[model samples]
Target chain A: MESRNLFMRMLMHAVIIIMVLIWVVPTLGILISSIRPASDVLNTGWWTVFKSPLEVTQFTVENYESIIERAGMGTAFRNSVIIASVGTLLPVTTAAFAAFGFSRLNFWGKRFLFGIIIGLIVVPLQMTFIPVLRVYHQVGLSGTFLGVWLAHTAYGLPFAVFMLHNFFSALPRDLFEAAYIDGASLLSVFFRIALPLSVPALASLIIFQFLWVWNDLLVSLIYLGGTRDVAPLTVRLASLVGSYGQDWHLLTAAAFISIVVPVVVFIGLQKYFVRGILAGSVKS
Target chain B: MAGVTLENVTKRFGDVVAVKEATLEVPDQDFLVLVGPSGCGKTTTLRMVAGLEDITEGKIKIGEKVVNDLPPKDRDIAMVFQNYALYPHMNVFNNMGFGLKLRKIPRDEITKRVKEAAKLLGIENLLDRKPAQLSGGQRQRVALGRAIVRNPQVFLMDEPLSNLDAKLRVQMRAELSKLHDRLKTTIIYVTHDQTEAMTMGDKIVVQNEGVIQQVAPPLTLYNEPENMFVAGFIGSPAMNFIKVKLRREDEDFFVDGADLNLKLSSALLDKRPGIKEYANQDVIMGIRPEDLGDAQVEKEFQVSDDNSFTADVEVVEPLGSEISLYFKIGDISGIARVDADSKARVGDKIKLACNTEKIHLFDRETEEAIK
Candidate 1:
């Protein structure tokens, strides 16, 4: 029996190693290609640099320079930051309050309202594009940052509410009751106890919402319009790889720049992400 | 400190009644314990008093005011949950001072009260440490300190010692009693452990199926249990029950069961004239293990002349000063407590004597104590 268990462990390790290589190799290639000069990148495979240390002299920062200065990448980067920050902030704050009400407060039709919210999670985002665009146009919000913010906030609400409500519901009921007995009103308990204790869940949700909005293209293009000054990195990067699709160097640099914020955010909040995900699920 | 009264308190969840019309008066400065098996609504009763749970159909009064519609904060009560419910994010001082701060007490006063509570609980050094950093016993002390800092009119605790280890539970039990004495505050504690109920409570309310079985001082509840439930619940190893028939042998009445017979005491017989109604009917005979002694002592008393029963010892458990002998008499198996020096062994024949005055008689059908 022990031999069988050991055999299973060995097989699992092999599968995991293979999966990690599959995900890591291409991203490593893009990073190496983005650093190397366009001539050397097109000439030799990125693997050759690992075998010869002297070959690293072929590396250049020109691809990054052109992407940032000539392609208006700086403006797109700022636009992406604005949209993603607002997108994450608005949804998460609203969701926290709404989720608390769904989980803790006693109200008429609470279960039914929560059921409708959960049901919304399964609805495809593509189905709401036209109807939401029409509303944005009627409300004089089209072609503005507020328009894209509203669009992303609407798209993010269902999942945000679902995740946070499940988390809020899992907290020990005794803790809330203790706060209530300690002379805290419902709003006070929410701000003082529930919100503070839910840092981990909030951190993870911030990472998720920030990443999704950062990498978004369709919603930004549709709501904020294809204006060069207002378009996010995703839209600008898509235009860089236009009909000819030949600027691999510029594409790689721009993509890497776009990926940096989320990676940094993930690394910063990783501890809380792991803890918040499991806090209310188990005793430990 | 103030007393709490629950009059006709009933709590229901859908179709199930959790606390059924419980009426209790917890006097000021008294340590009252509500004890029962799990699902007996002991915790529910405590929560209702804390206003954590709403009473379905009843009125609750704390210190002369009807507080049925008041929130827990307005009720001026402090509670220690079974899990301690210490705020994990806060240090011991902050957790204890949180209530005072919420009440908008001045900063210096809050600090003083928190420090005083910490000193009283002997957790002053742990004031800066979070609950997660503290051991189970330390966390329980912090919980108590949190309650004390509030200086509320009443204190409610729900199985506060249950999460601790056996040795820690015993240690904490004494500390809690001492804390109660020093504070002199009305406290309503709940536990499933009968030992806690017997040891800590000035007045113990024994409950079963959401109904109060009996409520009295610890000794009164132990010595004069109102029903079979109270009798069986109060004692360790439990009181033994035997099915017996009340039989009239000439002018005297006797209890006749399988492999045993006992002459009824005249005082017991006279006190319960209802036994005449069951002259030849089945009855329950209850006897605590300690009530039985060595047969040699039985010769002096005529009332115990018919109390001798022969049995084979199935097991002998030596517990320091006393030995518990698990023995069998025909089809009936029971335990008897004897001196530790007794030479009783498994499979050995022994004759035991019963204390006639300590025997309890109950009607078989109703299970109510006859005397």
Candidate 2:
């Protein structure tokens, strides 16, 4: 039985190794391609650079420098950060309050209101683009950073309210009652009891909303009108690829540059992701 | 500091009635317990008093003012829930001091009160630790300390010790009794455990369904139950009930029940003059387990044959100082608590003496005491 268990463990390890290699190989290729000299990248496979052990000439920072200086990649990076922060923060705060009210407070038409929000989830954002764009145009928000932030918050709210509501409602009713008896008003209970206990759920939502907003090109392109000043990393990268489709080295460097923030955010907050997803499943 | 009076308070959730017109007067400095089986609405009554649930049909006065329109915070009461309900994010000091801080009490005063409460609960060393880091008993202390630091007009506890292990529950039970003495505040406690209700409460309100059953001191409740339900609910192993008939043969009166006959003591008849109305009709007879003993062991009770009956002992549970004997007489089953020195064994026939004075009679239809 012990030997059979050992055999099962070894088979599981082998499968995991194969899965990791499948995921890491392409990412390693892009990273190696991003730093190589343009001629070396085009003339030979990215694998050939690894064959030369420590040849100093095989690597250069010119691709990253060119992307930053000539392509206005730095501005794009700053724009992505601003959009993601505002986009993630506004929806999470509003949704948390909405979720608390939906979960804990009693009001007339609560179920119907919540049902309307859930119904919104099934309607694709593409269906609202024309209407939302018309509204933005009338309000003079069509080509502004605030327009994209508002768009992201509107798009992000339904799922955020739905997810955080489940977490907040699943909390023990006794905690809120104890707080109320401890002389807390409804708002204090939301800020002190409900929000503190919802850190795991909030962290997962932040990662999810931040990554989505950071990587989005379509919404920003339509709402921000593809302006050079307001275009995010995603829009900038798309424009770079349009002009330099065959410039693999610069494209790889710009792609890597665009992905850096999301990778860091995901890695830093990865622990909360597992816990938050499991929050509704486990009892406590 | 203040008494709570509920006048015909009722709570209805949609179509179901959770508490039906519960009216109780919890005097200042009284530890009144509301106890019943699960789903008996004891917790519902407590919640209504705390203003967590709206009183659908009555007035609740915490002191001089009617508090039906007040929210829980404005009602000036503190509650300890069954689950303890300590804030998971806050350490012990903050958890205990949260209510004071919410009331806008000064920083150092909140500190002093929290420290004093922590010392009272022996949780001073644990003040820096979050609730998640504490054991179950420690969390219970923190919950109690939270209520204590508030020093509200009344304290409400809902089965606070039910979450602890049996030993810890007993320890906390005594500590809570002492805390009540020191604080001298009105407390409305709710528990389903009758032992807790009997031990900790100055007065216990027994409930069944949504209706209050009996309200009296614990010993009075034990010795003089108002109905069959209270008799069965108050004691461990419960009071054994048997169908019996009362007959008057010439000048003497006798009660006849399954393979047994007993001459009624004149003293009993004198105390319950109304028992004459139940003569020659079926009535329920209740006898506590401790009221029956081995006829051979209890010679001092003067076990005359008229007051004794034979039964086949089916089970003997020796509990060191005393033994519980399960026996059957004809078609009726009964239990006797006898001295451990008794030689009765399972499958043996033994004569059991009945303390005729201790037997209770209830109306078959109304289930009320004959007296």
Expressed as tens digits, the lDDT of each residue in B279-357 for candidate 1 is: 8888998989888755643343543457777778999999998889898878888988876667878989888888776
Evaluated at residue B364, the lDDT of candidate 1 is: 81
For each candidate, the DockQ is 0.77, 0.90
Which residue pairs clash within candidate 1?
Answer: none
Weakest ten-residue segment in model 1 chain A by summed lDDT:
A243-252
Candidate 2 ranges beyond 4 A from true positions: A51-57
lDDT of 2 by residue, A76-171 (tens): 989899999999999999999999999998999999999999998898999989999999999999989999999999999999999999999999
- For candidate 2 chain A, which ten residues in a row score worst on lDDT? A49-58
Clashes of 2: 0
Q: How far is candidate 2 from the true structure (C-alpha RMSD, Å)?
A: 1.8
* Per-residue alpha-carbon lDDT of candidate 2 for residues B1-371, written as tens digits (9 for 90 to 100): 89999899888989989889888898889999999999999999999889888888989999988999999999889999999999999999999999999999999999999999999999999999999999999999999999999989999999999989999999999999999999999999999999999999999999999999999999999988999999999988789898889888875667897988887777777877888888898888888988888999895578898778899999999999999999998988888898788999899999998888778889999999887
Residue B63 Cα positional deviation in candidate 2, in Å, after optimal superposition: 1.9
Q: Provide the overall lDDT of each model, using Cα atoms, as 2-decimal numbers.
A: 0.88, 0.91
Chain B alone, candidate 1, TM-score of 0.94
Q: In model 1, which regions exceed 4 Å deviation?
A: A1-62, B249-251, B267-281, B296-304
